[model samples]
Target: MTREEFIAAIAPAAVKLRLEGSPLFPSVRIAQAILETGGVIPAWNNLVGYKVGSGVLTPYWKGRSVNKSTWEVYDGGETRVRADFRAYDSVEDSFRDQDLLFDLERYRRVREAKTPGEQIKALLAGGYATDPDYAKKLDQLTEQYALTRYDKEVDDMLEQLMEQIRLLQEEVRALREQKAMTEIPVWAQEAVQAAAAAGILDTTTGGSYDFYRFVTILHRLGLFDAKGQAG
Candidate 1:
């Protein structure tokens, strides 16, 4: 497939997977596929960073290696084989498998992230790839392709929610101001009466009948600031 066609085909799938909480970003996946496969070079559809084998040539891979070498073996005692790696049926299947890899239990943290950047960071931090600069590379790809633009709708929703919160706060403040104006005089008279009965206020000479003092006393009694820290 052409480079544009390849990216266009996978972009929707990537966005859907991301909305479903996938750690891998669409741009990163596309870039990696381009780098690994040379954008339709060698006529192989492999896009998941598959490497050539150490031996055991297969019909699918007719190319020869620089030098035949053997690598480590598994517990089954099967000698290491070196040759060209396997190919996939289509790019869509490759992308699907890539998403599945991230959905594994080990990568659960990435799948839980709410944003694409968070998922990308988590994947890099979790050592998902061998590249030491994987995070930087992914970030570059994300910015170059404007992948975060995919979240524009989500950002708009958040902005509307914030506007609603501000309106609600203004309404609350107006209500509180109206209540305070209507109730303060009555509350102040009750406070003076209580202070007089308790001999806390000097009524004989009207000494220290400060309105500010009454207001402070009301505050201390938790009557003025009913909202506590929220106020």
Candidate 2:
């Protein structure tokens, strides 16, 4: 796939993960995929070069692996070696598997980072990549591609979702309060019922608290009675 197509295809998935509470920013995620695969998405769907370490599996990664040659920084030198990298059925699953890695306690700083730059720094400090310039390279990619726009997209979506939730909560509160207002209080129930039976009141529901009390007082004064007669 072309560079733009690759990014277009994965950006939504990355944003979705962020919206679902993945701490990683969409920009950082996209940059990692670009750097990991050199802007060419592999058919195996390992966007972030995650390895099948010790045959451990996550819910997103189903123990499938492919033998690949990868470069690692060792002893102040770059060395090429064959390794087992985790494979996924789709790009979204690959992104999800990466989220599982960041969920680890050791990557707590990555999760707590307030910005993409801070997250990149935390990833480096947490030994995410062995190369000394790994963070710098990712940062360059972030700026060059203006990938941070995806982060803004996620923020906008989250804000809209929160507003919808707030409106729903308000609706529920109003319904509850309205129900409370329409209910006949225990102290006024008998009097209101008497008033209704005598035709002194047309309705027994939806009266304000004060109205109920007034009806009860009239009933107490024998203005309306259980015999369904007006005094």
Q: Pick the candidate with the highest lDDT.
A: 2
By summed lDDT, the worst window of 10 consecutive residues in model 1 runs over 64-73
Q: After superposition, how far is residue 145 of candidate 2 from its true place, in Å?
A: 1.3
Against the reference, the lDDT scores of all candidates come to 0.56, 0.89
TM-score of each: 0.43, 0.83
| Tens digits of per-residue lDDT for model 2, 59-166 | 888888899999999999999999999989999999888888888898999999999999999998988899999999999999999999999999899899999999
Off by over 4 Å in 2: 191-205, 208-231
Q: What C-alpha RMSD separates each model from the true structure?
A: 13.9, 3.4
Q: Residue 42: error of model 2 in Å?
A: 0.4
Candidate 2 at 12: error in angstroms? 1.1
Report model 2's TM-score to 2 decimal places: 0.83
Tens-place lDDT per residue, model 1, 1-231, is 776666666566655654555566555566555545545533345565544435433433334323223343345344655544544455555555556566568777777776666776777666565555666776776676665565564455567879999999999988876655444354356554555455544434332335536644764575533323211
